[model samples]
Target: MLSTLGLGLLLAGRVGAFGSPTADAGRRGADDLVPARSLQEEVQEVAALKPITLRGGVLNAPPFAIDNGDGTYSGFQGDLLRRLSQFALEDDYNLTFVLSPSPTQYNEALNLVASDCNTTANPNPREECDRFDLIVGDYYCNADRSLRVDFSPTWLRTTMSAIKLAEFEGKGITTLTELTFAGGTACVPEGAYLSEVVKAKFPGASYNDCPDPEACIERLKSGVCQLYADDELALKYRALNDRSLEVTREQFNTQYIVWPLSEKMNPQHSRLLKKWMYKSVANATLDELSYDYFEVKFCPLGLSGPNCDQDCDPIHGLSDRDGRCICSSTKWTGADCSVEVEEDLNTYPPWEIAMCYSFFGINTLAVLVCASWIYWQRNTQQVKVWQPFFLYLVLLGCLVSSSSIIPAVQQSSEGNGNVPACMVFPWLFSVGFSITFGSLFAKIRRVYILFKAAVTMNRVTVTVKETFLICGILHLQLLEGLDSNHCRLALGVDDFCISAMLQDSQHRYQVFRVQVCGGRDDPKTGLFLRAAVIWMNDLFVICIIFGSLMHSVHFGPKKDVNIGDAVSEYARLEKESTTALKERKEKFVSRFSSIDSSAEPDGASVKRHSSGGGPADETIDVGSTKTTDVGSTRRLSAQISLASHPEKDEEDHVVCETIDDLFVEDDQVLK
Candidate 1:
């Protein structure tokens, strides 16, 4: 009876009995006898059994796969898986994802999936036997990994690099070779492919393995490691957010990241994954997805070539957008910065040198001639009155100031080689200015004091010693200038000591027109110091001019008054007038007495009158006449008048004489 049923169904199928409604009634009756299942019913039964759910294992790597803490995931790999799942759904493939358990590092993520199949125990295990059908993250495609799992088409291409604290760059650890030679400890994720590269390339360096990238970074931050080796993309991402971290410019070991599939995964599913990945790559969707997460394109730093295999010098070469090398400084030139540029020595032009020497010579000659003349006229009143000591100082200052031109021109000729000249220029100029101005200020101050004393009738004397003391005080500015120069030399900007190179259109080197003392391109601090010195000198000049004006106005010819001599002569004249007046009074009284006695005739009565009041009256008249005739008193009055109003013609002579007397007195006191 079962054989009859199966044969009848087979016959019904052949006769198209169940396939079309247009079948004859006879065929339909036969199919009803067989009781056959329909195609829709079979599909429903298959669907009811279970869906082909693919378990995808993801590693926790930022910008690749990040767990949302709510059992969801996101990032480049996450978005890629989502899009691949959507594609698979259209083809009846159900895809699901699962993150690696806590503390599952990148190097161990693949092993978690690969270990599930136990292929050694069962060579041909069921497709569903693996813990994960595929693993995704920044899994590098390499021969060692390929033995355990198959890789999908390349998802991302990047190079391996090391990251360190930003300060390490300043320590000259900007390149891989530098880091290796420095013998610093490197933090590497346990079982990471980078460990192999680090070991092979950096034999000089020691390394410590952390459970994962985060632990490695922690180790780096905690000072356990000076460098952390990882993929350039991930390291760059990490460095972008952390200002203290920096990615090394020298990257190596180009790697391709891909989804790792379990060795026991169904071949059909593996084909589907490869097809999807290749399609995404061809359509630029993979790059678009990468941009959605990374938001930046990857390019090896300071590397240039058709395949980015050429390395440019990190110190002297720069890579352009097209990955071609360009020289960053004039010190080097060539495609890869392998050639050293020859620099032409530049010096001051003949005319400038000649001019500087001429000025210096002329100044020297003037100083010598002035000095000789002053020495020859040492005994002259003009020279003595002017103070030979101060005159010599003025000449010395001129000589020193003019000598600064020597160093200035010499420095120009020597470029940055003349450090001593650079320091000497300011010292010479400043000290010279201080001496010259200070000396003049002292002289003017002395004259001002003298005139002031005369005007106020005060006994104030400004001696040569006091003038020298004042000059010495003013010369302290020299020390200040010295300190400023010293500071500039000690803590000056790099450019101050470094000479700049310039090439003309004709490729001719030009002299570095830098003034060692006060260059125009000096740093703000240096410029401020120089400006302060100039302002101080200008202040001195203003003070000198003002003091000179005061001296000239107060001690003009009309107002010349020698208080020392005038006061003494006035006192003498007053005493002599008093003595002369007393003498005349005495003489008058004696003469009146004699005349009264000698009177006769009317004398008896008159004598009585004269002896009493007449004689006294006669004595008073005689005294008045004698007082009028006293020439000494008159001469005393004339002398007082002359002192009060000196003759203009003699004013100059008197001033010269007064100055001479002052010096002479000082000389006498010193002797």
Candidate 2:
């Protein structure tokens, strides 16, 4: 019975379900069976196999990779690993994370992955070696490390940043340069890549190595180190939790965070891991996980908030260290610096403007009236002597000067129009001053020339056209100086184009100080030039007044000394002498006629003799009287000729009886 049972079991094992072994082998070879299997059967075979598990190295760094101490992990890297794990599961793989046990620094983790632990030649193997298939901590990708191990695609791109105690906030250590120049000690984690960066970039900064990131942070807090350098995101997280800490606004040494995969890792697994990482980036899943851990989103420049949707006002806003908009200028306010602050404009009051306008109007009217009167009296001697053309120019200058009030008021009232108004104001006032002073100077100079000629007894003739030419040349010089110097000077006046809005001590309101033409802060050269021109004009006026006094003293009722004066005086004397001679001749002639007609010649002759001389003898006396009267008239005429014709020889005794005759002969020539 035992021999029969053994034979039956052998037969059952040899000829199993499907066919005999020899028959199955003849139908298909072992290599051919793999291809011959149905797709569903192959899937079932793969499902029956155990999942390919990968061990990932983790660190205690918060916000990047954190160990919960309960055999679970959570953080930016932690969340990223879990998300990658889901992709692995779909493709028949598993991810197992293990925190670094001893020497839990990022460099140690990288070293563990870079070391060969599976070879038999190794005497002792670290537990880290067994656990680390890849380092999932915040490992910076660099050329030195790339030679030691492989790296995944970049998970995060960030820069090195520093953190300090809040007490050192405004100690002029806000920038990396300042911190480096200060020669303060910095706490750098052991084996961190940032050590090389600090040594190379900021050689002046003295750095000490701490055992771990936490130790470095403790050193920074206790004042053992002035600053702690780390990845920007990690420092920002620390600053958010610890109010006593402040992250520097400046960042340095751009670095990329990546997973350092072991060189011995399966090529298939490495490819799948990289594939999923790229997918996560494409779908924004990596960014979403980053936000979940960091509680802040990275935004483009000049933007902030959770969603990065808020815009900072470009003109007046500045972003703070934490990405919030702040008003950069006192003239702006509100959340994003969009609203302008109300300013109390420093300007002339309405009453002042009105008063100025009133004065301008009155002066304008007076100038117009004077100009009109001069025009109407242009042919008169008083107006002709002063040159009516120049007189009108003086009045025109007055009107132009008064018109400057318009722009002055406009600039003060409407600050926006300051530049144009300021430009116009200087030109008007300067041109007017030049015109008026130039005209007055020409008139005074003409008088001075006449006085000089009289004193020197010389004949110097200055025509009206020549006087106008001199005045125009003076005015041109003044106006040219204004155009080249004063007009440009007006442009450079303090706050000429825009009002200076300054915040008061209380910080409630802004004070807007309007710029005026020729402000006190104008250049010294411009002021000096203006003063010099005014002084020259004033000197001319003083000289003119002094010359007039001297001229009156020199001439002093001596009309014959000047031929021009003698001509006028001789005309007056001649008229009076002629009338007196006529009256005397008439009396003599009437007396002679009465004596001839009278019977008693002796009585008549006595009467005539008593009256003056007799007739016959008295007539001879009358003839003598007539001859004496005629001789007296001729002598008076000779004196007039000598006085009037001083330009001719005295022997000629040629007289110009009237000023009109002299002027008619000369045809109104100016002297």
Candidate 3:
């Protein structure tokens, strides 16, 4: 105690003697605190020029990028982009954010920006395309994406996991093997990395696909799919919010997340981006971001439900509740719990709980609309042959919507896993798509023959067997359910265009696609293709049974009358629609040229650029989803134009006419 007092006295004496440390080294120390390169110098390296605009994509995933219903984006990623611009370019660059439209479009948007082939500003003929420099939002590094584009350093390392209701965690699901033994299906986004592990580790188990995490949870709770698999962070977030769901394994595996730069980004801009990433990591950007997104205090994982150790002050609420945090005051919620609410609920409201219901609502409305259209034209004769196709579409919509599974259309987004939608949607989605697109394709093929056929063949019949065969080909993910769509949400996807499993980092993040449908169609060529190979083994049996029988069967003057002339009229309309497709394609190819390393964005200029595409400061439109089906196949189809083939002369203009218009010519002939 004497020594401590003596030391304090000595420090006071020294202060009296020299006044302060500032007296001796104030000038030098202050200089030392500044970076070797002044902010001005850093700006100069890139050259202070007029602000340049860069195009990028915005994907809605909370804590990363949250869509603010009013046409703006909020959350960690949104903030980071602003910070990065300030830190990297000193706020000199303008960013034009476009909605990616799907999970897989994360990289597509990046590549499109890099390649300048999005057909946005400059029409086809690559040299004149509109250009975007780079994009960032829940992007993970993977081998497949590496081939197509370059990525900045890994930004975050993601841990993969599966989640179940808290009460069921005590069940036999302690391990993946047990999950398989239990025989309960796991739910995942279509094509997610976790699905690969599920298939290999839990080979005997079945899994279903959902459009996203919230949808997956809904499926899990409803018993459509009993388990949910995804990245540990997101799963952890859900588990914390809804005490009902618990993360089975928080650290299943980790993968590096990164912000991808355009492959063709200017060298200066690339360097600047790298510098920004380095500085962000070194200068507390990530630290602050983590605190904001992951440090919520409302009954966090360890303190949830029965495990809670504290209670809110009685002044805030009438009483304290177990397993949930009760704030002492409305002004501050998590604060009284010794933690702070992640963000202001008013400024950043939660994602619409009933957004997923759009899958059902929209589809149901579509069914009603189509049915009504058919009813009105029931006696018109023009609608007779079209009824079957439209009916098929209505059935397809029901399956995709899975209204039966997602019963509580307005259910809160929190703890949505295990709803019946997960299980039922997958199988129905597969069957629905197979029947929908398959029928459309087949019918179009028949019309195509009649219109363009060199010779008038006698009679033709497309029996259910052929439809079944065509439908079978599209059912590559049938066994797994609708996982392909979910797989896309977890980027760096592999074969079947599936995301990479943590099993092998080297092979992680591979997504195989053959561009079609006016260059937007992404086909399942990798992992799902392997499933295709296995499915092919069933081919011989089908051929032997159906081939002979089909050959022996003949039709009694199949549906259409004077098919040749009817098809002729349809052919001309198709050709005109083909022209529309050509114009559309010519319009989307883009090359981001206005961007420069030293570009300084004026706030007004950035606002101007973003405003032109939409009615807001940020081009904030939700990417059209791959139906309610998991990423398994919808990403490949969601935004793909009906022009399956891009050629000027011949393209699949399947949707050029409504069912009514499609059959009008045929009806004319029959009548």
What TM-score does each of the candidates earn?
Answer: 0.40, 0.40, 0.36
In model 3, how large is the Cα lDDT of residue 415?
A: 45
What is the C-alpha lDDT profile of model 1 across 332-407, one tens digit per residue? Answer: 8888886898765555556656766666676677667667877876765445556678777777766677677666
Residue 423 deviation, candidate 3, in Å?
71
Candidate 2 yields a Cα-based lDDT of 0.63
lDDT of 3 by residue, 297-405 (tens): 4444334344455454444432223556555555556523555455432211223223434444555554565456556546433344443553445345344424432
Shift in Å, residue 61, candidate 2: 1.5
Query: What is candidate 1's TM-score against the reference?
Result: 0.40
What lDDT score goes with residue 517 in model 3?
Answer: 62
Better of 1 and 3 by lDDT: 1
C-alpha local distance difference test of each model: 0.63, 0.63, 0.52
Q: Return whichever of 2 and 3 wins on TM-score.
A: 2
